[model samples]
Target: MASAPQAQGLPLFYNDLQPLSSDLHANYKIRRAETAPFLAKQHAVPLTVEEFPLVQRYLPIVFSMGDEPVPLGLMGLNEGINVFFDADGKFRENEPFYIPAYIRRYPYMLARLRPDAEELSLCFDPTSDSIGDFEEGEALFEDGKPSELVQQVLKFNEDFEIAGQKTNAFMKELKELGLLMDGEVSIQPDGAAQPYIYRGFQMIDENKLNEMRGDQLRKIVQNGMLPLIYAHLFSLNLMREIFGRQMQQGAVAQQEQPAA
Candidate 1:
């Protein structure tokens, strides 16, 4: 669900990558996306700690299941199911949903040019129609130099990279403290005979959180990490909301099936 082939694993929504340069893409223009076809089938997206408060209000924030767990914003409880968006990647309802910066930064990201490269380079997905030679759109370069728009885009990606670093640090702390645990959520519709159980994800263990030493709790609070943790915990209720939406969209039927 992430990206196309690359020597280093590419992030989400990119089919191909090429370093942005005045020499190679001098005539290129960055166009605004009318619809995100790449996001149509993506149910979950990588999330940074910075977005926790805002993202919590709409999507259930959970951690991906693995030895190295990363935060994810759930668009749907199950794979290949995105209730918030339609087949064209447009919002299904008039109610606003917080679009994660990870999604907004699609087609462009900072990546190492080589495995041993010390510095990251501004690279873009060449397959994206958003960045290409076009008669109408914001110019990527002016007078053989990067335009103001390109600089702004670069700044956004740089900020995202910083946020990613913070997220990694946060995850490391959680792991060290032994806070995250395999998560499971079960929902039983009013008339359903069996409850649909969702699993294969990670979440903060509330039992462990409640039993933490005062000093450990204070450390996270002092660093403003407490609220972010709560945001993720509070957002878990939205799983049922998303499930309801799936039913309304006909993605889920009356029949019981395992959800993972």
Candidate 2:
């Protein structure tokens, strides 16, 4: 893990997002064990799978552990921890796709890790209309090949290194957490990649319906239980504004009724 950057002039929200517990190491180990196999099978390779509950999974952990108001520098790190799917299984970088900037940062990290002349100068053209714009290109099912994008991700992980002390510290933490998995999990560049599909969670229209249903259900049981549970505390603040306006209108109506 990199040293947390300086906190000068940063918002209080950034500091409020520290790790909920030191149990992240164990969580990550279990997640990796489970996801690796699923991804491998999806890609038609031999791999392991670990059963992970969606709510108790990666994004939640990252959100709980992330420093907030998140530094722009670290915003992408969380996105990288999760997997993505494309309906068409093909992506070009310049297009306004949903992939976050932080997710795109992996190629940069890979270039730093490998440092080969051809690889280093690969110029990840974030602005290009070419298919190369996205590191993971479309999965080629006919040839059983992963998209270029997946290749880039693997290349980066292959080359990442930490400072000696930091590496030791992370290792110690891993050992203490009992996650001393020895072998490196590699997704070969030429391996068949999994078909990309749209994640239902990312589907906005359906999600809106689900959210509304949850809101209504919670309101019935506890007035606004769902809002509080979902961390939409601002909704209460908005209600206060509406209440104030209603009160002002009532005051005007009372005055007019007396005058008439």
Q: Could you give me the TM-score of model 1 versus the true structure?
A: 0.94
TM-scores of all predicted structures: 0.94, 0.19
- Alpha carbon lDDT at 100, candidate 2: 27
lDDT of 1 by residue, 166-227 (tens): 99999999999899998899899998879988887889999999999999999999988889
> Residue 232's C-alpha lDDT in candidate 1?
98
Q: Rate the local accuracy (lDDT) of all candidates.
A: 0.86, 0.24
Error of 2 at 240 (Å): 39
Encode model 2's per-residue lDDT on 128-214: one tens digit a residue. Answer: 232221334343122344445446544543433222233334324323333222111111122324221211111012243254555
Best by TM-score: 1
Q: Which stretches of candidate 2 lie over 4 Å from their true place?
A: 1-84, 87-102, 110-168, 176-260
